[model samples]
Target: MRILLLGAYGFIGLAVARRLQQAGHDIVGFGRDLDLGQRLAPDLTWTGTDLSRLSSEASWQPYLDGIDAVVNAAGALQDGARDQLAASQQRAISALIAACEARGIRTFIQISVPGADPAAKIAFLRTKGEADSALQRSALDWIILKPGLVIGANAYGGTALLRMIAAFPLVQVLAFGKSRVQTVAVDDLADAVDACLAGEVPKRATFDLLAAEPHTLRDLILKLRRWLGLPTPTATFDLPAPMASGLARLADLAGWFGWRSPLRSSALDILSRGIVGDPTPWREATGRDLVELDVLLSRLPSTRQERIFARSQLVLPGLVLTLASFWLLSGLIGLWQWREAVAILPPSISHGLAASFVILGSLADIAIGIGFLFRRWLIRAALAAIAVSLVYLAAGTVLAPSLWGDPLGPLVKILPATALAVAVMAIAEER
Candidate 1:
């Protein structure tokens, strides 16, 4: 089979693509970033297609050619700077279904969620539900697999959040701790896709791929802690609902800046409601049980790199915020004391030249600070910070060399700030 896999570079999609390839299927991958998709799975053919832009059957034709079956793993949590849920999830699927029908391609596999409903209160679930319903009504042989919280070797979205919280030292702070969640290993989800493609599962059916039983969100975190080989925390704090909601709102605001924080309101809403579903349908169909939570965690490698990622993610937001705040304040203070800044230059320099340098440097600092607030601009911001800091250091060394050895160490402090910017640039790219 020559399969066209959408969102082929994503956590779930990549896993499925590899599984299919191992099963001797010729895989053609499609994603928003063609280069990234190719880089992630170099052996597979890849095409760049923004599903949000393909809301009509005509728009899907170019990529659908020579495709025998289609597996849609593409999805967005909510509408934000980089996503349009309705267009990508609902309208595009509808158009794809129509295109597939017109082209006489029947087999379709849809990856969905447990609580998906066309009339659901949350837009993420609603959009997904609308797409699922559309597939159900279409003439194609479609199978929908809605998995619970998917745990994998590499962390992303919900899994990343779990690892981050579990990595905290000596204390555990949790929100929606009592909410129930079933776990599904990413490999198991990939197996479900393989089953669908191999005609091992019934067509025109919906299956919830998950563990045999569910665990509380709190219990799940503890399991993650143990999985990460970390010592148990001495204290556990359950955050109040209002405080959690406030944090989620802040994450919602971050989404507009292209940061896909796991605490976004859409994610919180889903978590608060609980993630659970029956595994009986899928198990009965495949004649096998999904790996239990304990076994799932044990199978995934827990190495030094995973520990580092968890701890780093826990501090990432605060680090970015502190860096941005420092730069902004530095700029604002320089502007507020314009005369003092001008006076700091060498006595040999003209007053106008000193003032011009002060004003431009301060404004550059302000711009870099503002740039750090947007995830899309984070790399550029970090690079700019490094460049500007170097310029300041060079100018300070020539103009006021004594300041480097002064009590305040004003010129010396720039070293750490420049190093911090370089570190941010290193880890800012999202997988």
Candidate 2:
């Protein structure tokens, strides 16, 4: 089939694209990032198209001229007041369904969430349900697959969160810890879509996709920890609902900067309701069971990449925050205690030069602290921090070597901090 796959570089989109390509289907990939689309399907043509830009009145006439089917997999966790979720899941979907109807293209595949309902209070699920209803209302031969928690080899938002939590050294704490979810392997979901396209499964139907087994959120996380070869958590604690909600609120604040938290308010709301689906239809349609979590885990790549990601997840934040706090405080100390800071300098270093050092060094530290929060430029920030540390180390050694042997080990600590900065720099690259 000549398919136009939206969100072609996303976690689900990548898996679906690969499965379709492996099955020898022609996939015309569309996504927010054309480079990512090209990377995901190097052999295919890619169009940089943001579904969030699509509107009900927009014309997508010619885009579907040669497409035999359309797969809508694009999504976002939070809208961030941008209305991006509605744009992608509702308006854009309605537009596409209408256009496909005009062109007499019947096959439409919708990747939906497990608990989506048009009447639901949650905007995410409501938007999904609205689109699902649209597809069903249209004359197109639509297939809707609503999967529960999707666990794939690739570590993305939710997957990354799972690994990061599982990698915790000891006690595992969470909110909504007892919520049950049935996870579906991304590959299995991809295969199901492929089967539907091949007419092996019914068209104009909806199926709830999930594995045979169900697990509580806590058990699921522990299972992942075991899969990663991490020791089982010594204990698991569910934070009070109020505390969890507070954290989610903080996450929402982070969303203002385009940084999404998998544990945001909307996400916590969804988790509280549980991520679950009936799997009987999926099994009956496929005539086989989906891959077990253990099997999927074993098939996943557990190499240096995962280990590094897990380790970095555990340490990178502490390193950045510690450095930020230290630098910001150090600058304050220098500025607030100008005389003490300057007095430590050699007599050859005039008071004017010493004041300049105190002011500029403090400002530099503050700037680097701010830079650590931006992922796009995080590597450069870490490198800049390392440079500053080395400069401080070298200058301190030359200026007053006595500080190196100080009881607090203030100067010696820079050596390790520099090393950590290097590590953070290595892991901060866009993955």
Candidate 3:
């Protein structure tokens, strides 16, 4: 069987693609990033095309031809430009359906999130509801798989949360910490997709794919922490609804300008309600137990690799601070000596220098990030960068005391970098 998979570069999509290929099915993986596609699932055929831009029947005709089924796994997990989502889902689906129909393709599998209430206020959930509705009404034979919180080794959001708990000895509990969640493993979900494609599952049926055992958010975190050999996290405070809402609103406002706020009120609400569902259908259909959360968390790379990755993330910000310190020191020297240093440098030259610093810093950071991502060369890269950044800071302080400002200014600037460096070290040691 030939499958055209949208969002094939995503966490779930990659897992599904791998499963399909392993089962001897040919797949055409479609995504925006050819590089990510190749990196994540090198074995599969990939097409780098913006799904939303291909709105006409002709645009999708080539890909849909000879495909056995169309799997719509494309959607955003976080808030982004409204136009992008509109194009990816609304416009992309319209074109895909038309192309599939014209090419005599009949099967469509729509992967959705279970707890998405159509009338709910969250835009993400609402858009998912709309897409589910659109697929149900289409002429093609369809299977909708709405799974609960998907837990996997390569998963982003939820897996990140688990890693955080594993790294931190203590964690603050929120309102939804005790709320139940029927987490599902990515592999199990992939199996379900494969089964559906194999015609072993009912058409036009929507199944809530989840783990057989439901656990609260707190329980899940605790298990993950134990798996990573970290001390259990304790809840310190419970945020009030008004306060949470205000913070969420502030985050939404900041998001307008590209400022990301980690916590949101809608997210809190989703957590509070908890997405609980029976996994009987998924278990019966796939005949596999969901991968244990503890096992998945434990399988994460060594502490050293995590440390290197964390260190790499700081390279860009560290470079920014380092260069700013140098620039300010240069200006101060010119001011004190009444020199024409500032006037001598051309504007273009200054711009070029700044760009060069950014490029070099970014490349170094990427190298470390990749090392961290692969769980290799972490300790050496992290330790080396930490020592270098510290030396740079110390030299800047001694050579240009004025640029360092009062002790308080230097302390303030250094604290965050020091904290970040320490975090990298701590994460690396977790392994």
CA-lDDT, candidates in order: 0.91, 0.80, 0.64
RMSD of 2: 3.2
- Candidate 3's TM-score reads 0.69
Q: What residue runs in model 2 are displaced by over 4 Å at the alpha carbon?
A: 37-41, 56-66, 81-83, 102-104, 286-288, 298-308, 338-343, 347-354, 391-411, 429-431
Ranking by TM-score: 1, 2, 3
lDDT per residue for candidate 1 within 1-431, as digits (tens), equals: 99989888998999999899899999999899988877778998988677889999989998888999999998888778998899999999899999999999999999999999999999999999999999999999999999999999977888898899899989988999999999999999998899899999999999999998899999999989988989989998899999999999998999998899988999989999999999998878889799999988878899998898998898888889978998899999889998998887887889998898898888988989999999988988999999999988998998899898899999999999999888887766578
Question: lDDT score, residue 141, model 2?
Answer: 92
Candidate that scores best on TM-score: 1
Q: Candidate 3's residue-wise lDDT over 133-179, tens digit each? A: 77777888999898888876553544544444345425644445677
Candidate 3 weakest ten by summed lDDT: 337-346
Cα miss at 83, model 3 (Å)? 6.8
- Candidate with top lDDT is 1
RMSD values for the candidates in order, in angstroms, are 1.1, 3.2, 8.3
Taking all chains together, each candidate's TM-score versus the true structure is 0.98, 0.86, 0.69
Q: After best superposition, candidate 1 residue 222: deviation in angstroms? A: 0.4
